[model samples]
Target: MLIIALSTNIAMLCLVSAVLQIVLPNDAPQWLIFGNIVVFVACVYYTYKAVTVWPDEEKAATIS
Candidate 1:
């Protein structure tokens, strides 16, 4: 659940960055573009992990 929420938020950030890229002038700073790419990659990784490697609540409960 937490991963889901986090990935969702990251996805939202990626969306916002994409929108900004489209709306803002082409002269956006290099760092901003790099940051957006980094965020997008992170979002993809988290989303993939969430889908493929879900946490086991039973194991989590046992550990706690």
Candidate 2:
């Protein structure tokens, strides 16, 4: 579930970036920079969440 969320977020971010680049003027740096920051923060958040939910295969096998 978390992996799905992470991938979806990243994919959406890329789509947004592409759309913004096509629609926005070349001189506009602010929007692009802001988008980049938001994407970075989202990636960091998802990464942290993913690490927590990730299965510990080694520990599980040992326990079994």
**TM-score list, all predictions:** 0.58, 0.47
Residue-wise C-alpha lDDT for candidate 2, range 1-64, written one tens digit per residue: 6675775678578657756766777765767657765775677677777778887999989989
In the order shown, the candidates' Cα RMSDs to the true structure are: 3.9, 4.4
**Clashes (candidate 1):** 0
Model 1, residue pairs in steric clash: none
Using lDDT as the measure, the top candidate is 1
Whole-model lDDT, candidate 1?
0.78
Evaluate all candidate structures by whole-model CA lDDT and list the values in order. 0.78, 0.71
Q: On residues 13-47, what C-alpha lDDT tens digit does candidate 1 reach at each position?
A: 87688778868888777777678778878887888
User: Candidate 2: deviation at residue 38, Å?
Assistant: 0.2
Relative to the unseen true structure, what is the C-alpha lDDT of residue 3 in candidate 2, on a scale of 0 to 100?
Answer: 77
Q: Which ten contiguous residues of candidate 2 have the minimum total lDDT? A: 28-37
